[model samples]
Target: MAAEISSDLLARFAAIVGAKYAISDINDQQPYLKEWRDRYHGRTPLVLLPGSVEEVSAILKLADETGTSIVPQGGNTGLVGGQVPHATGNELLVSLKRLDKVRAADPDSNTLDVEAGVTLQRVQEAADGVGRFFPLSLPSEGSCTIGGNIGTNAGGTGVIAYGNTRDLILGLEVVLPGGRIWHGMRHLRKDNTGYDLRNLFIGAEGTLGIVTAAVVKIFPKPRSVGTAFIGVDSPADALNLLHEARANGGGTVTAFELMPRLGIDFVVRHVSDARDPIAEKYPWYVLLEVSTQSEEGVGDALEGMLMAAYEKGYAGDAVIASSLEQAADFWRLREQLSETQKFEGGSIKHDVSVPIRLVPAFLDKAIAAVEAFIPGCRPLPFGHLGDGNIHFNVSQPVGGDKKEFLAKWEATNEVVHAIVAEFHGSISAEHGIGQAKRALLPGVKDPVEMEMMRAIKATLDPKGIMNPGKVL
Candidate 1:
């Protein structure tokens, strides 16, 4: 039962956080009400910026008692509408930006206890300050918070070597639905618990609970980093090159990204200081990376592997970065691929994953299916080839109207997702199924798993006050 907000209840909330922090003016809370992509615009009765964990608990207690829904948000850089509130204008939006803190950093243990509100880039710098590495590299790291990363279990270019955010997390400090704080922040390497409750909140998309703080694992800074650009005939050759590099490099391979010639052209035209590393253009391109803890001859090893690949006809043309500056520039081209698409036209995108071995087939079949639907539609599929996850995006045909192109979003999604299903792949790979994909969940999710998710939601949040209308 949804209860109407009374003047008395609003006053109580205002008193908990002081008048300044409890924002009610539309202009004051506009940034919090709108998502980063502007896809989902929400209205809230009040936006509460809690400064501490205890304050968060108190706000939740009041909401639970009054039957008011609470939506927890961090940097609000999410793609799936996970951080935005509903359009009802009745829910309370809880912003956690004030809780940013670095509680501890232990170089000996290679671990850091950081608050949820800390930005991902700040976390990386803190690790680098201590001469350690925090390899959760993403394009949005400058704005995305650690809590949002853990909530969505974010995966970026580094996942090929370091895995996703879930793999780097050792433990968490979460605030449960009913206003109780669960402090399970331990630095233990091995703990055989009955059930790993910490993982339950991870990738839950803030449905299970709000992660307040966490203790995350860190790695030693690689002494040597090498990057290379290779042109391939097809996705099959990209896969073969990946296998060869890993076998020869012996686990030092960190990234293997796939991009089409069209995507590279977009970057070169739109992005500043972007140029092709090689003179000749192939149908497909791959930016591969290798990192090693030892200072000895890592670049030599990478060049040697690429030479073998070229001799065996796996690579058409190639360029290995001769210096760290060149390596960074090479990666910048791959990282900005998605950003460059906006200038071309509206894009219908899918972040999906399949078995590593089946990726080549998935790409071929998906491209064929999409072209059949909309002729001349530029299929810009790229990202994390080593992990079998690709940001499969379709840019509108040349000289097409942006609005008209986006009007067929649903049709494009169906065609692409159908191919994903055929390969036994996930519809939402690294990004969670937020409000954007809520309607499509039942069609793809197993009935038994859906029921279990609902059951857990009911048990933990019977009143449905935590992030309502999301991921259900």
Candidate 2:
């Protein structure tokens, strides 16, 4: 239960962050209200931009006392509606962008302390500045913040080499519901203490608390790199190529992406200067990258692997990047796959993951099911094939009504998701279960596991003032 947000109550929240920091105007709050996908839009009475942990603490303390609902937002680039407030305009939106700061950087220990508001690109740049590498790369790295990454345990292209945000995080600084600061930002990697409390909030989706800062691990930068774009007959060949890549690189393969010809066509048609890496357009393509600490045999390894793959009929035409610029161009095509799909029309996207061996089967069945259900919908599937996550997106047919096509979103999801479940895959892989998939969680998750999650939420936030109606 939460209290009604009156003008005076809003004024009280504004006093903590000062008038300049408080955003009461509806127009100013619009940007924070909607998600990037434009699928979930919400309204809030006030949006607070707090500059310090103490300010965050004070806001939460007062919120707890007043029984006010608090929705924590970072970067506002989240696909899920977890960052957005309810349409009732009663919850308070606390934006962490002002808390941007690199508190510490130690290349010697290969770790850095960053506030929640620091963008992922800035973190990568900071790591590079310190002669290290932070491998949590994302397409929205320019705007997505550390807090949001931690909230969702975000997975990106580098997830195959480096794990998700949970694996990179050493510890997190969180503000509990009653404004109590949990100073758990320890940099030590081998602290086998009592309970592993650091992970409790990593993928909690802000239902338990607000993450204000984190100590994350950095890695040694690779001295040599090899990137390639290969044409494959189908997802099965792509999977076989992935097997050859791993066997050839032997722990050096960083990314193996699967992109359909339709996705590449969308990118080429919509994105300027986006050209196919291979002149011959195959049904499926793979963007493969491998890196090593030494510069000796990366190129030779990639060349030999492709040669073997060609002999086995796993790959058709291939182009290994000879220059860094060419490698970037190859990546640009893969990264722009989702962004350019909008030009095709309304897209129903699914971030699902299956076991690596079952990727081809899952895609085959899911694609067939969606096409049969929607008749003329374009199935554009692509993502990190090395790690088993696929961005299975379906674009509406030519001259189709966008609204009408989108209206079948739920029904279409049922068609695709049913196959995913048959394969023991996850419905929401990288993206957290925000409002979009909140209702679907119970059907997919174990009953006991769901109950345990609810008990933890109630234990941490008894009043349920933290991001209500979000992930249970």
Candidate 3:
């Protein structure tokens, strides 16, 4: 809504954060303009790196006064183009990487306060250094930032036991629209005052406010661990094994992952260090883990459950890791599945979730639906079976044209999402509805829910400056 950015506006932005931190050159902004998946390439005129909250306030004040749009970015590792600017090339990009710092860590209270720019892996290392555990582990933890994770409400492998990024957060410090900072960073577990603003911004995908820092809950590190790689007869068998393991371990099953046999084959064929934990081939495989505070019988519990499942004909074969290195080797097969898919030509991806009891039915119906829609299409469905979140991806037919297959992205998406809708499942489970899923929101969300969200967004960001064209 504002006019083209003038020299005065650029100079003021530079004055707030020193000139060295403000960049306007077109060539220098390429790194910040693109996203991780290369799905969205936005265009912007300037990139600003503010070192402190005060500088961020100053920049927002100026931007609001001039009606210039602002796009906040962190690590540039988002998959849904939530942190990138729009294609208009008019908004300014604000990077929070300079605000990387641990404000405080209270081990007694089991809380750690950190700035938004801190890398997730760094926060995990800090928690480990203090003999505590932060259980938000993701594939992009090495390069992703806490702000981006909170913005997306990221759900990683540990979500089966712990929770999503929103559940781990105790409080947040956000800079609101028009340069007002909300100091709501409390470590208390119960705060039922009025409206919970923190929850609104947690999964808003940066469309409400700019999150500066947060106070996150931590837990005592596990003392004993167990990991197992099992070959299952089918998805139904895998779900049955999950219930059996949870029952046998006294609800201590920390992680349970399901993958198609083809995913394991792809990983073994592509990744050098990733070899199949189980030599036998089945239609489906499961990688499970259980941890306990006491170091008495972690491995025994896993083996006993597997044996019971084998006796019942649910499990075909199993391999329990004997050492820490062996456990890691077992997990390598699951974690490397996504990266190995790159060797395949073109892959259409979907992150959907259903009730744990209905996961088998949903997968069966969706896979059959996609195959019927396009014959010979390869479907690789894998993810956290315990939580019912599956990464249902489809590869092009063997020796098919990559571009031609990719051109049917919408058709393929419809075939899969129709089955999801029929089963009352969500189209996006872990990855949020950023720019990628904005247009499809109305089709999935109820009218009443969409109205409530729109009301909240209008109340918080009336001018529509905070991350336009995303989420809502």
Candidate 4:
């Protein structure tokens, strides 16, 4: 049974978090309820924007005592319905947007102590100000919060080198259900302690608890950088170029992306400031980059790698950015690949990851499958090629009905995921399974793993009031 969030209960919430922050007005709560894809429209009787960890603890404590489910939300930029509430309006929404504060920046330790609501961009800027880099680069960095990133274990373009949010996290401070605060925010790199409680909440999607704050890893700012967009005949050829790039530059290979001709066309047509870096259109392309913390030879190394790939026939042609502005322009094409497709109509998207070597074959098989499923469908596969994570998206064909094309989302997902499973790839690569992939979880995840996850959830959140309908 759903706990009734009565007027008296709302009053109590207001008392705990303050009246102005406990927003009950439907108009004021729209942003908290809606999300990026416009798929999940949920209802919440009250939206609580707690400003402090103490306030969040108080809210969680009260909800646990009252048996009210809490949907802990960050910036609400999550693709899955993890950040959104259920349609029943039975759950209470808790927004951590007001918790936007960088508590400390320890340059010696190479770590930044930041609150959950701190936007990813702000954290980056703060790191830059201190002559350091927090390299969690993504399209949604401007709006996505680090807390939300932690919740989903987000992996952006930097995953080729720095790694996912989980890897970048040094420590965490979480607010468990029933209001107990777990202050495991140690900045130490070596902690051979018992079970890692910090990791439990890192990718839990709020089903476990609310991440109040985090201690994130930081690095010395790179001094030199190089960017290139290569024209390739096939995904196989792209992988070849990847090997060359890695052999020459190794760890300097920061972001390596596989973009299809269709994706490039979409970016050129839809995005105003962006243009095709490689003038001639090839069947496929790879937007790649290399960088070094030492300024002397990074650019020359990148140029030599690109030249070698071209000579080997792995690359048809390439464009090496002469200046930082041009490099940004090259990356602009990769960054807007996903958003530009919105102009094309409904898209059936998949965020899957396979073995580095199997990526080419995976793409070939998946592309053929989707095209066969729906003739005239445009298979736009593009993403972090270095990490083997591809955002393989299918755009509705010309003169196709938008609703009808979107209706095939589930079927298309199954088609692609079945092939993904054959190669031992992850179905939910970066996007955490909220409502969108909740049903698909049991089929994809191991039975033993599922049981273990259930046991943990049951143990920690015995009342099952923490984001009631999300994750497991």
Candidate 5:
């Protein structure tokens, strides 16, 4: 049970954080109480903006003593409503935006110790300043924080090379529910000391504890990057191109993204300054990237791969980016796809992943199922093909009522997820199971695995005071 906040408890919280940092007025707390996607809007008794880890610990300690629930929020750009609090207005919203800092960076060790509140874009800039690269690239990197990325184990275009946020983390600094801080900020390449605790909190979604800081791995900056926008006959051909690129590109393949013709048309029509690169449209398109340490012969290698693909009828048309501006332009077309789809009215989106070889079958079956539900519903299937994760999204039919279309969210999700289950794929790929997917967890998770997760939750959060009613 959640405890009600009294005037006395609010006064104590205000004393820990300054009076200005502690907000209780509904108007003052409006921004922090809502989520980025506008899907979750809640009421909170108090919003606490702690400036330091010590302040966070003190606040958590006070909340623990008072039996008050605490909800941790970072950047507030999460898609699944994980960073928002419940609607009951009983939990205390703890915003870590003030704790943004880069504690240290050692290029020799290829690691950087950064605070959780640091934005993903800022981390990338910091790494670039030190002549290194932080390869966690997401569409919302400008607004999403390192804490939320680590919490969700976010994957983006770089996953084909650098892996997910969990893979990039070498150590962490977390504050547990009882207000005790765990300082495990080591940058060792190999530390075989018992079980790995750092991996535990990477995708926990702030259920077990709050991530205060982290020591993340970095890589040497690539001297050259080759980008291409290719038109493929189908998703199967895109996969074939990916395999060929890996074999002939000599380990330089970094990203392989798939986009359907409808998705590209949406971006070109809705997104500003977006245009099609190819003279003619194809059923499916692929944006492939290769990064190398040597500047010479990288473009030649990419061209050679595409030429071979064309000879085998795998590629219909292709365009290799010749300059840095051209490369950015090619990526811009891919990155703006999600935003462009918003103008098409209500949409049902599923972020799922399957085995690499099963992607074609998954796409074929998912689209067929969706069409069976509502014909001509404009299926916009696109995402990281190399990782077998696709952002399978459905836009409302042209001239359809948005409310009536969105009313079938549950039905649409069932149709898509059933196909995903048939292929033995995950319903939630990079996004964590926040409040949005809490109800669906039991349906997909095995009975024994669900019990084990509950056991861990009970052990770490005995009082159930951390992010109540989220993820399990």
Candidate 6:
């Protein structure tokens, strides 16, 4: 055990949940310490599994009284290190897995009240069970929890239509620094009572408070769905196709994903049963889906849009999925793009966003810059082109030392992020600024904006016991 945590202190905290729930053994704590990408590893003297909101409140209350730092984790699938504790072993790790429960499901109101530990897939299932749809569809939905999604304001393929997590959530139940519970879970569409408090914690990433439960909005299930994979000449061509789809899709264009041939190559090589949707290889590809309430013309609308785009020289080749299985197959290729990159070697990832119109220009400049900086590196730039969130990932050169290439993570970020700044893009788009980008936050954020954020942090967490060394 670390010198900072006394035996008495550990036991005192353990007693709140139970001896069985408080995990102090290093082996048991290992899973909660390291992030998925292995980018950040931390150490904690104790990991508390809080089963109830009262237990979480009690833990935070005691931590506040003793000036102990607390790191709250949900699902342990965070790409960034925000959920992990620090290496000093002075902080306490609070896992919300035990809090998993669907508190309420009101199909009439089109909302579900769930605890923070509920997996995103479970939320979707709950919505589907009630003949509704919760459209936050991330590749990690099977493991990532609702709290983590709201904590990061996660965006996925459905963002073009349904919006980010912030837009999907109606209200939140938060536990403040001193163990005070803020019961702000309202199920109203338009509430003009006072200041919007839920928005503050939506993307705060557990620094302000722990989201115990939430009321999330759900939409009517689409009556019909149309999926298509199209080959494009470049990012510019994809943008043109997106414009045409938007004008003709009648607001049914739910997803417009931009992927490169390199990403497709990686997926097809690494994933079993994965194959290219298009017969011919193109510089870029688009995975477009149209979902609508009207089943009559959904397929025809999508086909008409694609046909018009093809005639206008926007799409080179296209394949409209005729069956549900084929559509799932196409989605599998897009979803596996990130996981398959590991097979090639080290990958430096950048999640950035710019104005919709500036995407092509930004991609051209950033890709050229990264390629020039690291010769022979494979850049796999792909993501939601409609919403302007690009996952600009670069794999290490063939037969290159993984460690040597990963050592350039910071330098590569500087090169790419500099171009992002030129296009007025955000350095961190859907992913929150965890430990990975904490230092870089200042350079990208405006001075006044940084000052305001710091002030908010100080006011909410004066002792700085809530998730230290994160966000602000």
Instruction: Give one clash count per candidate, in the order shown.
Output: 0, 0, 0, 0, 0, 0
Residue clash pairs of candidate 5: none
Q: For every model shown, what is its TM-score relative to the native structure?
A: 0.98, 0.98, 0.98, 0.98, 0.98, 0.98
Worst 10 contiguous positions by lDDT, candidate 3: 1-10
Model 3 compared with the native: what TM-score? 0.98
| Candidate 4: tens digits of C-alpha lDDT, residues 169-281 | 98899999999999988999999979888889988999999999999999998888778878999989999998899899523788889888998899889888887776788
CA lDDT for candidate 3: 0.88
Candidate 6 lDDT over residue span 9-62, tens digit each: 889999999999999899988999999898889998899999999999999999
Over 4 Å off, model 6? 1-3
RMSD of 3: 1.2
C-alpha lDDT of residue 357 in model 1: 89
lDDT scores in order = 0.89, 0.92, 0.88, 0.90, 0.90, 0.92
* Deviation of model 2 at 96, angstroms: 0.4
Which residue pairs collide, candidate 3? none
lDDT per residue, candidate 5, 157-255, as tens digits?
A: 989888999899999999988899999998999999998989878888898889999999989999988999999999999989999999886447899
Clashing pairs in 6: none
| Residue 359 Cα positional deviation in candidate 5, in Å, after optimal superposition | 0.6
**What are the per-residue Cα lDDT tens digits for candidate 2 across 225-264?**
9999999999999988988988985338899899999988
- RMSD (CA, Å), each prediction: 1.3, 1.0, 1.2, 1.1, 1.0, 1.3
lDDT of 2: 0.92
User: Using alpha carbons, what is the TM-score of model 5?
Assistant: 0.98
Q: Please say which candidate is ahead in lDDT: 4 or 6.
A: 6
